[model samples]
Target: MPRRPLLRNLALTAQTVGEHVTDDPVLLALQVSRRLPRAVSERAAGLLTRARGAGVVRALGHEMRGEREAALAALEARRGSPVHRADAALGLGRPDLTAALLEAVAPDERGAGWSAAAARLAAHRGDLEEAARLAARHPRNRHLARRMAGERDTFRGVAPSLPTKTGHTPAPGRVLHVLTNSLPHTGSGYAQRSHSILASLRDGGFEVEAVTRPGYPVQIGVPWAAERDVVDGIAYQRLLPARLAQGQAARLQQHAELLAAHVRRTRPALLHTTTHFTNAVAVEAVARAFGIPWVYEVRGQLADTWAAVRGPEALESERYRLFQEREAEAARRADGVVTLGEGMRDRLLAAGVAEDAVVLCPNAVGGAFTAEPEDRDVARARLGWDVPEDAFVVGTVSSLVDYEGLDTLLRAAALLAPRCPELRVHIAGDGVARPGLQALAGRLGIAHLCSFPGRVARADARWHHAALDAFIVPRRDLPVTRSVTPMKTVEASATGRPVVASDLPALAELVDHGRTGLLVPAEDPAALADALARLAADPAERARLGAAGRQWALATRTWEANARRYRELYARLGVTAPVR
Candidate 1:
């Protein structure tokens, strides 16, 4: 909702297109000469002109099976005018045209937006190598595209368009999903993580059911249903309370009782609960009574998360000690531990959990992200951004947190502003830090250059990624960040933009310095500024890093790949695979 962010988004999209055409005087002349209505503002017309004048029109025209001649004619008609031929090409699926436009644009300037188009084109041609290679270059659109390409290339002619519901062998068995916080509202990390896994498990041929938090609100006027709603061909129990409990614990008890009764009736082979809060523990007690195997997925190191939120003073108190002890007990006793990253695995190992019992399973999105040519114009117009297309844009799509290093990045931006006059900084997600960040930017005399797009839809986050010349993860060095894996890093890498990040341990593993991104010392604004400047100044370096990062994600970080790892772990536990 922040005006700065919306304007920033617009600026980024224009900048993305501009990076490719800025150096081409012919293209520039063509763009500016188009005798279109003066009502068409310089910012809006420039974006459309870049898209058309750049190579996408021919590519999209061919793909759409439209008259390439006619499209070309339209483009030529606006040769010196502000026309939207590139937008038309995008609508028509002209990969060649799009690619032509994007060919000269380095990933740093075009960022994820440009690379995603190329990757999709490669995927359509059944070229897994090209798709995987391209997917690796962009940070935002990695997982889904890579999965499709890999599967198609690996299992082509041997397997169906989709992975078989039932593999050669039937799936191990039913895995019930317990949703303690199932409300659509308050979509915290835990909800997204659980939902993604539920889909993956069901797709991987595990019978799945969900019991929502007791007294949880329904999506609409209708109460939640426990029916055969197909989730990857597996049943889902979408339970919502008609009227429910008072406190958090009380709500958990009611949900547990409901789940206990459901388990008695359904007799699932395994009950997997998500998060460290009351939902899983309550259900674990019931599952124990039922003599069923129960698994817990820890999204974060609870003790660390608590400490991060509460500070050291609280950790020294007896209350905090008890809280830590309880979490440790839960983790110790769980049948198996599923975690977000290697950091959590290390934490569990230190906590005396059996190494074999812990699994590294991070959260992810499903489905490939493809760019729509029409999206370029519509999104640009909607956001009202008009910076000349030739600017260097760096962006981050996350809630503004002190831990996220927005403050550090702001300082870095201030430092780099003098040297990189065309550099623009975008902060997409909003949180408690907004006012202070605004104030800081103003004080730094760089308020005019910062774009704060407040909170954005998860789906919309991609556009923010697409608009950037590079994406950043500015997490401060802290115990929590060191032990935690950020979702944005995964999202950013998948999009194919070069990443500039703190040299935190978890991020260190994810971002290979000089390859995927530049890793700066934590909390060092100068280092961050330098890294950003390096990418901004060198187009080739940004492309190299972005391309390398995208490839790594496709090869190693897809949800399907991660799910397979989890499946192998479940097999070790002797859980039978469910029917497809």
Candidate 2:
């Protein structure tokens, strides 16, 4: 919002929008739907559905809008080129079709019309080197070219260096966190964890405050958001600009400048930033300019997360390769790095973060989760959930995404429906995968017994945990799932609910096989169904596992304990508060 950068940003935004609409209307429609009002969403939807002349645009839009079958059917019915059909199929999540369609077209025959699609396919199917070469051929599409490059490439030499502080005095105890989003406005597990960590640090006597990425709550549809919000005594500062700089690279630079100015004003002694290198790129720059220590929290392997939505092939993609490089770069430059689970610690080491510099700070829980849980039926009634008193409910309260593998849960429910007449699968959360999962449930003929009550409130998280007879963490087997520890899993264990999670390394760290909770093979619906059936049939076994899970959670995972560890870590890093 600074007068100096306003004109430049406006011009860039205009250029970006013009290119976006002209070259990639499919993405433009999706972006408008998410960022704009209802009228625009309707218009965008119509543009795709009625874009009869442009087969590629229509097909891509249909797929992105969660109508995969419609997209594929329309593409198949059309008399489009092989590359056109392949692009549509890929967008529809049909890699098999993409392969088949591409098989008919010679590699040398592919021109600019097919180059972008080929680049994406190569990225998904093979290596980045080839994909990057393919992507670079598309001179008109800057976004696609940048997508294949590393995030550091976007902000190359863009870290802002501010002048020496003059406005505020340095307080050793004051730690400012740079985050992508935060509580109230964004109710993601990421946001929840941010608040908990900030609250923990505040309670531990550090003057902790958070600053969300620029244009955060405002851009995410919270038009009424103020500059500051104090939730549970932990203050969150918003950076709402009238408009964001044009593209990702430009926006990151702008965010860094804004953050640098904030550092000048608040003058914290240490900077702490979480995963996904964007936050780090900005924070690291500010920390350097101010000559203060910074901590990078590797909360998740976000590159692998993006790959999950695509397929296993995406593990070798250009985006994945670039993302990992940037993450490693950020982690290596930090004064210290913190991560969840031993799996993630090993990943950090593998990613080139110094072994001695990184520490394990697993996802943990507190407050109501520390106490005895309410009766399952009582919780259901309190939540106004319609269900039989004797029904055996098995579910999870998590963001419904492809990586979470709720489709596998629905499949398991279908398998258990006939035998376990009292069985109910209630998944509570919302994401891009919800609609597809719901459609899959209906297709599996178990929609009658399944209930997806969307996203739950942060305050009602405990109640949702208690409402289930058993908690499920049926995550897919992927690079991300294997490394990143989920917060909901620990919260579920803490709430005295027997957790049935995938046998990934991260989940294995929380669940002690058959003792604390059940661990099934990832993506195995039959294994999941078998485990759930056993729990449903044996009340005593369920009670025993639940109690053990609670004990394990209390002993190993608590924000209070985590806070002590962090306080100690701060001391070791020379970031502790000075004695009054």
Candidate 3:
């Protein structure tokens, strides 16, 4: 039988659920659509609407037969509703709807809003090739494109899949982190890494106070985060309000100052600032004013970030040059630099910063999942996972992005799928690339051979890690990727999973080719496929590699061990006395 139309079924069910439970149709649609059957999903196309409860109910009840005609005609009815028309066209899966929708679009209309709608429809239909094509064509939709590319990786059986339950809250910490956004809201990989490190610090007995870019329904503030009345035995502080306007930088800065002032009043021994946004800079200025030495975790080449936001023209303009100058000045002025890898440290040194001023704290295993095999097995079993005794389950637990190299894994899976039919590829993440990756798998005819677990919680991250025969990091050789360490590589090693990663120099530091894990050429699907085959043929080699990796993690990478390094570095900068 043809695959069920899960997406269609979901739209219908969600529409029904929305009418019964909530007045907000959009949220209901999102909620109900998630539970729809595959067959229903296909037939329920064009159900997409940003409408309120009434509009959604009306749209869902409308006959699918004349919906396309009605949507195209409605384009003429509304003067400035390209978003509505584009959404309709997307739901209906009509390419012709593009022309009609574009006809009414204003010259200044953000083209991306419409493109996002189209991408959504393509993704819903599991047509990632089409989604990627549309996403890339829309130049302003870089984030959309990146998301789609990442989804493509998941479909190709790469990355850790996250489980979507309600949510998983980590234990509270002693240090308070007053900074910008949280996981999903952050625009870049650096932000994600920063959050991960903060969590690690919390694990190491720091009363970590966190206040994300405020004003979200998701109440991730400290008092609420802590199960006990207090967080890390300290009163939580979350005073900053979420910014309402997108372009009001100066206003946001003023609001950020109030929060920074609160931090200053508290005068925590160590004030860690993560991003270069308004809040971070404010915190830094306050710490400097108080004569507090702050640790500046440099995630990116600031010059590169500035260039990415403003076009090449800004490179020569005084404004761009000034931004770069200030960024350099900030680094020079920072007491101690906490960078991701040696590459960042080397760059800072080359820029004439003193070598001793930098401390390299690449993403390390935080000892979250270092339990015994029986404990891991119990965890996996409780989570409803059934691993075959003989199965060589190779998996990844990362975002399914193009840079993460899901395509390479899919291609490798296709080649390995026939030889090692028992070799199941499990992906533990999701993104816009989902449709593309799924399409690639369908094209490669290995769809049935892959298991997608969506997004899993941090609690279950280790079990997923322990279950894998070999953990893989197939990163593309992008400049952003080259400068960063794959956090999962270290996490997987801590779980004692042998790794098969791309042979990048930064990753080479983590994975010793023959000793710790096998290394494959970047983007070379065939090489990745061959490496997996080699590991599958030799279980003894896999076991040896896994053992070596676990030892390396214990000797060099746990967060408690790393946090002391960070504390010592701060002391050298005259920030505080030793923690002991």
The clash count for each model shown is 44, 0, 59
Put down candidate 2 lDDT per residue, 1-580, tens digits, no spaces. Answer: 2123344334444555665554444445544543434355446656777676656666655654556687677766645677777765765567788777777778788666577776667756645556557767867645666655433345243444456544456687999989989987889889988888988988888999999998766655455567788788888887766666655666777888899888888889899999888888888877877788899998999888778777766766556776888888999999989888898888888878889888787889888888888887789899998888789999999987788988888899889888999999889987667656866887899888999777778889899999999999999888888988899888998889999999999889988888878999999999999999999999899889999999999998999988987887788778886665
Mind giving the per-residue lDDT tens digits that candidate 3 earns over 123-236? 544555566677776776665565566545433323221222222222222344555544433323444455556655555555555554433212221212211112223323
Which candidate achieves the best TM-score against the true structure? 2
Off by over 4 Å in 1: 1-172, 182-188, 217-251, 363-366, 369-384
RMSD of each: 22.9, 4.6, 12.8
TM-score for all models, in order of appearance: 0.64, 0.85, 0.66
1-580 per-residue lDDT for model 1 (tens digits)? 1112233334334433443243122333333333223244334434543464544433222222213354455443434212234333333334455455556455466555455555555543435456557656755655434444443332221211111122122224877777755424435556555666766766787766676654332322223233224434434454433334432344455666666667767677777776664555676677666666678777765546555644455456433454455556667778887887887788778878788888887655445432221233344445666665667878788877667878888899899999999988889876545545766787789889998766777657766776778888888777888988877776677667788889988888788998898889999999899888888889889878877877777777767777797678677666767544
**In model 2, where do residues sit more than 4 Å from their true spots?**
1-23, 28-67, 79-90, 94-152, 155-169, 578-580
Local accuracy by lDDT, each model: 0.61, 0.78, 0.59
Candidate 3 runs further than 4 Å off = 1-176, 181-208, 214-236, 240-248, 277-279, 300-327, 373-382, 577-580
Candidate 1 vs 3: which has more lDDT: 1
Full ranking by lDDT: 2, 1, 3
Give the CA lDDT, 0 to 100, for residue 87 in model 1.
35
Pairs with backbone N, CA or C atoms under 3 Å apart (clashes), candidate 2: none
